[model samples]
Target chain A: AQRVTQPEKLLSVFKGAPVELKCNYSYSGSPELFWYVQYSRQRLQLLLRHISRESIKGFTADLNKGETSFHLKKPFAQEEDSAMYYCALSADRGSTLGRLYFGRGTQLTVWP
Target chain B: DARVTQTPRDKVTEMGQEVTMRCQPILGHNTVFWYRQTMMQGLELLAYFRNRAPLDDSGMPKDRFSAEMPDATLATLKIQPSEPRDSAVYFCASGTGTGTNNEQFFGPGTRLTVL
Candidate 1:
């Protein structure tokens, strides 16, 4: 079955510390991956996508097809970066319009 | 600026009552999606439409849940005899393109509570 998994429910980090949110997915065909973030009381927004190869808000994710992973990382976490992050995958099949399958999510708490 | 718009930021209703949620997709966005969010399940896609036509609705409950785009600008999700289990934050999102890489813009979800 196609699935997305985020092993940790919550992660805590101090200001200026390196942060990593793990994401793994299982799909039959080529996978299109994305990272979305939601700030407190805000709507969900796109953070980055594997194809873009662009970093957003000092965050970058690398798609490792061999490992079937697209983990988000930032060298120095900021207090403002604390938010709920979700990893999503869209299947490769062309028959259907893109449908996002999201992991439960990881809540990153950055403390001073 | 382009953004999806959803109505009734919050709703409280009794079971077995009809519930309607509406969404207005950004102009030029051909695809619209309905999703349900909960603390436990995160986000689950309930239905998707493109070009004012139904593409897929397999994720929704056929008996009680119905999703439609009566016109290009308006999309609605209706639940008849809604149950307690149906209580959730429903989100509407839209994107301009067709592929998986198309970035979707989401509206502030409607939080539904069943009493």
Candidate 2:
């Protein structure tokens, strides 16, 4: 059973504060991890992937294998960064390949 | 910029009514996906296609939900005799699996309401 878990339903922070959205996974093998964000009135878009190792809009996520976690982090939160974020996983090789399993999602709100 | 597009951004219909949602994947993308999102479920993948062929629709309700890709650029998801539980924002997404990423590009989605 492959699952993605986002523990927080809602998180709030002030501008310039650091934030972390926690995510955990249960997969048999090395699964691809991703973070998707949906801003208000906008379509969902890829924020970052574990393989890319690229930070988009100052947000970065590191996959920790030991803990089976892929937590999204930002050193300084901005008001524009507030959005609904989802943690997703896909098997690298299997019948379920390319099929994404998404977490329940965490809604982040940054107040100015 | 290339983007996946979905029609009928919003729909309000009574229970047991049939509803059809349309999607236009980005040109040249081989994979298309249909998903339903709700406050309770978050996001659920109903079905997906590759090369205009149905690969997996196991996530969809077999009796009332169906998805088809009539062409490379067009995909549709139909719900026959929809129920109140089916009311949610349905999204269409397209992607090309380039290496290990396979990042999906999503559409604005169809917000369906059932009474």
Candidate 3:
């Protein structure tokens, strides 16, 4: 079974508009959730983590236990925000233990 | 300016040939991870090491793929008898794997193409 799920493969938004990328996960106990971003010709970098409870580049994510979701949100989309976003979780057991299980990723494009 | 570095940024090989990719993790980092990114499956963890010791490689193909950390700074992923399906970008990430600073720093990645 897939541990992390990001439903949207592609999303587009206008500049200055709000944008949200949906992510959901399944885990029994507490899990560490993180969002990573990759820009063109660049390496993947950490955008933010739920544990840190901080926002980066105007983006924030909240982990909802009841819904099992950790959605990334931004108030205003910028052209620089146009990149691939991946939702990931670190498990505590088996193959996933101490390692991250990443979602397929959502490519967000912000149009001017 | 400590960052993960990978060698052979791009590789073009033939099917059934052996392919090897190398990574140099950030100095003092305790964990190193290998991942494969493709159009269909996205990013998949192939293997990971903690403190220069292999912790898990279950995500890798048992017969064809092998991963190892020769030292704290060096990690390698090798594929024997490569297939066209093995073509993808391979990334190596390094992190402290400790409290509050578990964020992984990624390398530029090795783009492989098998013909």
Candidate 4:
């Protein structure tokens, strides 16, 4: 079975502190990984994908095949960065588009 | 900016009532999806459509849950004889997946409550 796991349900850090949200997955083959964020009163939005390798809102995630992890990290946390973050995975096959499997989200709180 | 849109931002009904939620995917988006989000379950995919055709609805309950794309721009999910377990936020997302990433754009979800 394919599954995405966000080990931490809540993570807190002070402003300007470094933060990491851990995510791990279980899949047989190479699966596409993505991070989605949902802020208070806002809709869920895509943060970044493993393939893009682009940093969004100063956050970047590196897929570690050896560890089966795709942890999201930020050098400096900001108060505005507080939100519910979800790690998602989709099989590399053509079924990845609208059928993403999401992990139980982690709530990040960046306090000032 | 292009975005997916859903109607009836909140709905409250009695048990065994029929509930209908509507969505309008981005203009050119070919793939539309319906997802349910709850504090307990987090997020679960209910159904999806490609090119206005139903692709997979295996995630949805067969007896009471149904999804349809009546036209190019409109997609609807209906539940007959809804149960309390069905009370959750239903999200509509759309995207084009032929490209590199299968990033989906989500709409403000519909919050459903059953009494």
> What are the iRMS values of all candidates?
1.8, 1.7, 2.3, 2.3
- Writing each residue's lDDT as its tens digit, candidate 2 over B1-115 gives 9989999999999999999999999998888999999988898889988888888898899999999998897999999989999999999999878436678999999999999
Put down candidate 1 lDDT per residue, B1-115, tens digits, no spaces. Answer: 7788998899999999999999999988888999998888878889999887888899899999999999989999999989999999999998876445667889998999998
TM-score for chain A as predicted in candidate 4? 0.94
* Model 1 chain A: worst 10 consecutive residues (lDDT sum): A90-99
> Which residue ranges in model 4 land beyond 4 Å of their true spot?
A94-98
Task: Please list the residue runs of candidate 3 whose C-alpha ends up more than 4 Å from where it truly belongs after superposition.
Answer: A92-97, B98-100
Query: Candidate 2, DockQ to 2 decimals?
Result: 0.64
Instruction: Estimate, for each residue in A61-92, the C-alpha lDDT of model 4 and write its tens digit.
Output: 99999899999999999999999999988766
Lowest summed lDDT across 10 adjacent residues in model 4 chain A is found at A90-99
The local lDDT score (0 to 100) that residue A10 gets in candidate 1 is 95
Residue A28 displacement in candidate 3 (angstroms): 1.1
Highest lDDT against the true fold, candidate:
2
| Global lDDT of each candidate | 0.90, 0.92, 0.90, 0.91
DockQ score of the complex predicted as candidate 1: 0.63
For every prediction, compared with the true complex, DockQ reads: 0.63, 0.64, 0.56, 0.59
lDDT string, candidate 3, A21-68, tens digits: 999998886778999999986899999999989889999999999999
Per-model chain B TM-scores are: 0.96, 0.96, 0.96, 0.96
The parts of candidate 1 lying over 4 Å away from their true place are none
Q: Write the per-residue lDDT of candidate 4 for residues B1-115, one digit (tens) a residue.
A: 8889999999999999999999999998888999998888788889989999898898899999999999989999999999999999999999887334678899999999998
